[model samples]
Target: MRPEALALLAAACWAVAALFSAPASQRLGAIAFSRWRMLFASLILWGIALASGGWRSLDASAFGLLALSGVIGIFIGDTALFACMNRLGPRRSGVLFATHALFSAVFAWFFLGERLWGWALVGSGLLVAGVMLAIVWGRRGDEQHGWEQTRGRLAVGVALGLLAALCQSVATLMLKPLMASGIDAVAGSALRMSMALLAHGLLLSTGWRGARPLAPMRLRDAGLIFGSAAVAMALGMTLILQAMKHGQAGLVAVLSSVTPILILPVLWLVYRRRPAAGAWLGAALAVTGTAFILLR
Candidate 1:
């Protein structure tokens, strides 16, 4: 498959995982859900790495970089994303999270010295406008589905989602050079997850009340969490890194953040209601912005 297709496939994986995330994150709480998800992902990736001898390519320097990348990307970013989901639900949260593509472009411009002066600037404005539009008007006044209910302050969830996007972009930027140099995607991903799992372990050991799950995990919750962990962390993220080996960071991110567009149909199916007009318009703007960056 082409690198761009790999990025889109990663987006599909994330969209499916987002469907599971609302339930599991609500049941397990964001921190605990993330802990379990990273644990599962770490183990699965390690199994693949060892079996395929991908671990052989992991030097100490590679380990250090990938490990830090994992902690920032998966540990902080995934936790914040789920916390955002807990408050904003998946659909709106997804629109917010899609800003990572824009964030990645900006970060690349500053850090990697990638140029961003043409259509990219216009797209950035559109992306920001779309995010605000979705958050402000994505739901009807009468729409009271569990997924659309605001859990806490709207401000807090929006902050977390954008923070998740920023962290994701930074982490991806950090890994571009390594991935482009032919690192084994599986082993590198395993190392990253392992480091993130370690971070979660320490966070749990702190007995921070906020870090604990509100309820015990049910069998069904376990299934949901495992499936999401396997699909999103083990497969989707690895595919993004693989795409990075050949694709430009901005293009890859723009494609991978198509999660907002991909998740809407499933959301409609589950709710038995079409999305609000604002949701459709916001998604169209965000996707068009992505295409501007992609095709430029």
Candidate 2:
């Protein structure tokens, strides 16, 4: 498939993953769900790596980079994101995550020397503004008016979102160097998941006090969540890394800025949820701006 197609496919898969994961978060708790999700992803990626090549094909440096990426991006970024979810709620957290594009662009610029054009700058600004508008104006089922009951959570959400963005940016920036040095994307992804596994283990051991046992789940729910995890987080990330290998970082970043749009339709379908008109408009604006940035 073409790089753009792959990136869009990845985005779609990520959206599907989020659909199943929201309920899982409510059931198993976010930390537990995240850990198990990574565990499953690690196993899947590991098998793919082994099928493609023996373990010996992975070098120490590549392993190190992947490991670091996994820990920082998956464990730290994801954990902080879950916290943001609790504090900011999904709508606000969703908007904050749009910041990842800006952070990623900056990281790519400094480390990879990826240049942004004038339209790209304008588009990114619009995208950020759009997402913020969406969050600020969006209303939930519980909220009759937009921005209701978001007092303390907003501040915490912003901080956590910034942390998530920083970790994600650093991890993404590291990918270019690793791939340039000849790391196989599949094997690298496997190693990254392996690091995530270790981090999950640590979190379970130290971070999750009074963690609940795995709850009994319906076969349908289990299947959906697992499928989502494989397709969204693991497969999507692999495709994204592959696209980065073949495409410009700025373009890839711009395309990825539309993940929340991919997310909205899925949420509507699965949960019968809909964003407020303002939120929808904001998302549209963000996508429009991001598109301009990429195309120009």
- Candidate with top lDDT is 1
lDDT of 1 by residue, 1-296 (tens): 77877988999999888877788899889999999999888899999999999999889878888988988999999899999999988877887788898788878778877765688667656755665566556676787889878899999999999999988999998999999888999899999999999999999898899889999989999899999989999999999989988877876787787777667777778877777788788778877776676566
lDDT of 2 by residue, 47-146 (tens): 8888878455577657677788888988888767766665655556666776777787777787778886688678767876776777667666565332
**TM-score of model number 2:** 0.83
Q: Which pairs of residues collide in candidate 1?
A: none
Q: Where is model 1 more than 4 Å wrong at Cα? A: 116-137, 282-296
> All models: lDDT?
0.85, 0.70
Please list the residue runs of candidate 2 whose C-alpha ends up more than 4 Å from where it truly belongs after superposition.
Answer: 1-5, 54-57, 140-154, 206-221, 271-274
User: Which run of 10 residues does model 2 get worst, by summed lDDT?
Assistant: 144-153
Specify the poorest-scoring 10-residue window by lDDT in model 1: 127-136
Task: List TM-score per model, in order.
Answer: 0.90, 0.83
Model 2 lDDT at residue 146: 22
